[model samples]
Structures are given as structure tokens and as C-alpha cells.
Target chain A: MIHLLAFGMIADVLEHPEKDWPWSADTAMLRAALIKAYPELRDLPFVIAVNMDVAGGEQPIPPGATVALLPPYSGG
Target chain B: MKNIFIQGSIAASFIGESIAKHQSKTDIGAHAIFLGQVRADVIDGQPVSRIDYTAYEDMALQKVHEIREAAFDKYPLTCMHIYHSLGSVGVGEISFFVFVSSAHRAAAFDALREIVDAIKADVPIWGKEIFAEGQGSWKVNQ
Candidate 1:
């Protein structure tokens, strides 16, 4: 399983802090699955982090890798 | 990793103590501080009462570390400290504090501004503005 974490507005939309997906999925596939499950996320801008690093869409998610969906920063 | 996050609104005493700690460094001639306070902004006629901050901790810390290194490389500064709130901070409360010291005044001022701007833009921190009416909205940086 691949662990997924959500933060900020993305968390509010997901209504949950974390979830798990199939480890075979790459970043692109995972994003597609997320957009399918949470359609609102499609229009919102966010980035995917794989193992605590910002990842491109093509990055593969290895088994047990920690992934996160991060929305635009609002910090001062 | 040096923890830069405070759990709630930063206390005035903490800021004072931080300043006091630097008294032993006599070579530091000037210090510049920037404090960010929560404002009660009215949105759709509802006043915001507080802000709840959250972050992707690992990534945020890494980004902060990079920012610190870049600052030190770009500016001639003796030392710098950055503190940001991680939880709820009420209106009129301090949320962010940036302290920079240098041998000269010009470097302090310039480095302080650049560092703060970099943090605001680069860090993976988020703020949710809670309204007086119990509703809240995710804050968007403008």
C-alpha cells in the first residue's frame, strides 16, 4: 500500500488526513484516482510530494512510500 | 534540525529572550525584526477571529533549511532566527517572527526582508482563517 497525506485546503476537501492506495500506481495514476474520487481537486492547484520531496507527475511511488498532497502556501 | 515552529501565538517574552541571548555577541551592530500579526479581516461581512496554521512538516523544514543556507550565502550576516506559529493564533496575536543580526545596518535590513519574503513564498505552510461565526476559509497568499 502507498500512504497518502493531505494538508491545508486539500485536507479540508478530502475530509480525512490520510489514505492508502495501490503501490503499483505512479504519481500520475494516483493523481487521476484522486481526481476521480474527489472531483473538486481537479480544479484546485496543488503539488504531490513523494517521500517528503516535491515530485513530478511521472515519479513512481514505491511500496510504503509516503506521499502528500499540498496546496498553495498561505504563510506569512 | 533546529525547530522553528512555536505551538501557538508567540509570546512577547520569548522574543525578548531571543534578543537578550544575542547580547553576548558584541560584533553584531544591528538587529532587524519582523513580526506578523493576525488581522481581523472582514470577508463577506464576517470578521476573522483567528488563524489555524498547519504544514507538511518534513518538506517545510527542508525548505526552511534551504532558505537559511541561501540567506547566509547571499548576505553577510552574523546570525538569524525565524519562528512561526503552528496552531491557532487569535486576532492581534503574533504569528511570525524573523530576527536577523549583522555587523552593519544595511545587511541586516536587506537580509531580513529577503529572508521573510522567501519564507512566505517557499515554505509549505498553510493558514485557515476562522471567522467569528464559526466558519473558516483557507487563506490564499496574494
Candidate 2:
């Protein structure tokens, strides 16, 4: 399991195995893997974007990859 | 070459040394410096005391590189440096610093302004304003 670094909110990997990621999982099987591995993030109000693209459908985060969990940016 | 971002607090010595390093170039006759300081502002009947900053580091570094390139191309600048805080900054603490050196006053002045504007608009950073009374809110540049 890769250490997911999120700035604001915590993501639970124990609750949802078959469900797609909050944003998008790259592969159908990978989506299943995430939910199975981290089911705790299944119901959170969060969005996942890769390279700033919000992945929404059945895409899984590429295996062995790291991504930023950006909710929104507001700074002066 | 001095990297754009540093982990420690920005001291007056850092600013002075950065300027002194470029002094060897006699062609550079002028240097402009800008520092952005945090202020405790009242918001919704609460007083803000500090800020916590975070960024999309990879994206921010890329944007800084692009700004440096564009600044040199658009103006006759000998060199420049930009620094910003990535973590918590209290009231009266400095958060942003931009320094520009050029052959003349006009170019340095213009380039300094451009760099600051670009940093505010292009950088993927976020700030949480901490209030003196123990409350906070997300802040956006106006």
C-alpha cells in the first residue's frame, strides 16, 4: 500500500473495494482493489483529480503512482 | 544558482545577501525588492492572527521556472529571485519576497511588478487564516 498524502482530509482505504475512487480509477479492477483496500473513503465528499483533471468515472489511480489530493486552492 | 524556494523563515540577511551576490555585475545598475507581510485583519468580527500555507509543490516550481524565463525574455533583467512561505506565518511575518535586477531602474521596477502578479495568479497555493480568538478561514488573494 502506497502512502497517500492528502493535505486537508483523511482518506479511508478500508471501506470500499469495488467502488470507483472518489475521482476516477484508471482500471476497472484497480477500482475494485481500492475499495477493497480502503473502504473508509467511499462515502466522503471528496474529489480526486490527476494532473488537475477530476477523474470521475471508472478510472483507478494508476498502480504504484502518487497523486495530490487537492480539494481547492485559496491563498493570497 | 539560488533555488526559488527555501524552507526556513526569510530573514533580512537573506534579502541583503541575495542583493549582494548580484553586486559583482556592474552592468546591473538597479535592483527592486518587494516583500509581502502578513497583517492581522478583522473578518466577520474576528481578528486574524496568522496563516498556514500549502502548495502543489511540483506545479508551483514549474510555474516559478516559467515566470523566471518570461521575465528575462520580456525585460532586460540581469537576474531575479522569488521566495514564498509554504507553512504557517504569523501576523507581521513575511510571506512573499521578489527581487529583480536589471540594467536600469525602469526594467527592474516593471519586472518586479510582473513577477509578483504572476506568482499570485499562477501558483497553486492555499492559505488558512488563523484568528487571534482561535478561529480560521480560507483566504484568497484580492
Candidate 3:
């Protein structure tokens, strides 16, 4: 299982800020699965981060890795 | 990681204290400070009276660490401090503060703006605009 975290609108879309999912794959696959699970995610803009680092492309997600879905930053 | 998240609005006294603490470091010739106030915004006739902030703490601190490192790498900064509100901040209250000091005015000024901009663009923090009567919407940084 891998730990999944979400923030902002993405958390609202997922209905939870963090959770554990029984899935282990690269960042791209996780994005697809998430969009498939929650169609609302498809309409939202966000980026995937693995282990606190923003994934540049189809970055691999090692087992037990922590993944985060971060929406556009609104900080100042 | 260094905790930059403050529970509420940043007080003027706190800012004064921060400056006072730096006076001992006489080598610093310039200090640039940036404050982000929660503006009372009107959206669809609903006025935003406060902003509720949130973040992924670990990730945010990590990203901030990176930003801090990059600034130091690129600038001859003597000191840099960043603080952001994490809870409800009322309109006209200070929610974000970036303090940068250097041996010269030019580097301090440039680093302060870049650091503030980087936080807005790269950090994971979010602000929910709470209007009067508690009606709210997500804030979009322009």
C-alpha cells in the first residue's frame, strides 16, 4: 500500500486529506487511477508529488512511497 | 524542517520584535520585509471578511527549505525568515511575512521579492476566502 495525500480543491474532490490506497505504480498510473475513481479530478488542475518532491514526468513510485496531489498554490 | 506556519494573524509587535532581534547583527546593512494582508474581497456580491489557510505541513516546510536554499545560493543574503498564517485570518490582518536581510540593499530587496513570489507559486498552502456570514470560496492567486 502507498500513502496518498491531497490538498486544497483536490482534497475536497477526494473528500479526504490523506489516505492509504492498495496501489503501487508510477506517478502517471496513479493520476489515471485517481481520475478514473473521481471524475471530478479530471476537471481540476494539480500536480503530483512523490516524497515531497514534485514529479517531473512519469516518475516511478516505490512501494510505500507517499504521494501528494497539490492544487494550484494560493499562498502569499 | 523549520516551522513557518503561524496559528493566526501576525501582529505588528511580533514584527517589531523580529526587527529588534536583528539589530545585534550589525553586519546587516539592509532588511526588506514583505507583508501579505487579507484583503476584503467581494465576489458575486459576497464580501470576503477573512481567509482560512491550510497546508501539507511536511511538504510545505520541505519546499520552503528548498526555496531558502536556492535564495542563499543565488544571493549574498545574511539572513532570511518566512512566516505564514495557517488558520483563520480576518480582513486587514497580516497573513504572510517574508523578511530578508543582507550586507547591501540591492540583494535584500531582490531576494525578498523572489522569495515571496516563490512561496506564492511553489508552496502548497491554500487560503479559503470566508465571506460575511461564513460563506466561503477558494482563493486564487493572481
Candidate 4:
């Protein structure tokens, strides 16, 4: 299982901030699967981070790695 | 990884104490501070009463430290401190604080702005604006 961390509106949609889900081959697949599971996420703009580093492209998701779904940062 | 999250709105006395502690650093000739207050924004006819902030703690610490290091490298700063609210902050309350000190005023001012801008853009934190009637929406940086 891979770890997933969702924040902000995405977390509200997911109903929980953290989860362990079946692993996907790459970030593209992960994004697709998450949107499928939570259709509400399709309309939002966000980025994926793998193990603390923002994913630049469709990269492989190492087993047991933590992935974060980050929305537009509103921090000050 | 230093935790910069404060439990709620930062108190004015806390800010004053922070300044007082720096008095012993005689070499520092200038200090620049930026405080972010929760604005009473009216969105779609509803007035926002407060803001509730949250963060991915592990990532925030890492990101904030990197920001601090970058500021130090680019500016001759004597020291820097950052604190942000983690829970509900009422309108007009201070939710963010950035303090930078240097031997001269220029470095302190420049670094302070850069640091604040970077934190707003790069940190994995979020704020949910709670309307006076109790509805809330996630806020996005402009």
C-alpha cells in the first residue's frame, strides 16, 4: 500500500487527511485513480508531491512511499 | 526541522517579548517585522469572521527551514524567526509573523519581504475562511 496525504479542500472532499491505498505504477495513474474515487477532485487545481518533493512529471511511485496532494498554497 | 506553528493567533505580548530578547544581540542594528492579520473579507455578500489554518506538519518544517536557509545565503542577516497560526484566528488578529534582523536596515528589509513571499507561495499550509454564519471555504493565495 502507498501512503496518501491530502490537504485543504481536497481533504474536506476526501473526508480524511491521510490514507493508505493500493499502489499505482506512477503519479499519472495515481492522480487518475484518485480523481475516479473522488470525482469532486477533478475540477480542482493541484500538484502531487512524492515523499516531500513535488513531482515534476509522471514518475514512478516507489513502494511504501508517501504521496501528497497539494492545492494552491494559501499560507502567509 | 523547527516547528513554526503557533496554536492560535499570536499575542502582541509574545511579539514584544521576542523583540526584547534580541536586545542582547548588540551587533544587530536593524530588525524588520511583518505581521499578517486576518482580514474581514466579504465574499459573495457574506462576511468572514475568522480563519482556521492547518498544515502538513512534517513538510512545513522542512519547507520553512529551507526558506530560512535560502534567506541566510542570499542576505547577510543576523537572525530570522517565523511563526504562523495553526488554529482559528479572528479577524484583525495576527496570524503570521516574520522577523529578520541584520547589521544594516537594507538587508533586514529585503530579506524579510523575500522570506514572507516565499513562505506564502511554498509552504504546504491552508486557511479556511469561516463566514459569520458558520459556512467556510478554503482560501487561495492571490
Q: How many backbone clashes does candidate 2 have?
A: 20
Question: What are the per-model DockQ values?
Answer: 0.87, 0.30, 0.86, 0.92
Q: Considering the two chains of model 4, state its CAPRI-style docking category.
A: high
Compared with the true structure, what per-residue lDDT tens digits does model 4 show for residues A1-76?
8999999998888998999988998899998999999999999988888898885677889999999999998987
Q: Give the top-scoring candidate (TM-score).
A: 4
Residue A46, candidate 3: Cα error in Å is 1.2
Writing each residue's lDDT as its tens digit, candidate 2 over A1-76 gives: 3324454332223322122334334535544444575575455333444444445554456544554444455544
Instruction: Tell me how candidate 2 scores on lDDT.
Output: 0.68
Quality class of the docking in candidate 3, CAPRI style? high
User: Model 1, residue B49: displacement in angstroms?
Assistant: 0.5
The TM-score of predicted model 4 comes to: 0.98
Models ranked on DockQ: 4, 1, 3, 2
Among residues 3 or more apart in sequence or in different chains, the pairs in candidate 3 whose N, CA or C atoms overlap within 3 Å are none
What local lDDT does model 1 show for residue B140? 83
Candidate achieving higher TM-score, 1 or 4: 4
Error of 1 at A44 (Å): 1.7
DockQ of 1: 0.87
| Model 2 stretches with alpha carbons more than 4 Å out | A1-49, A52-72
- Candidate 1, CAPRI quality class derived from DockQ: high
lDDT of 1: 0.91
List the lowest-lDDT window of 10 residues for candidate 1 chain A.
A53-62
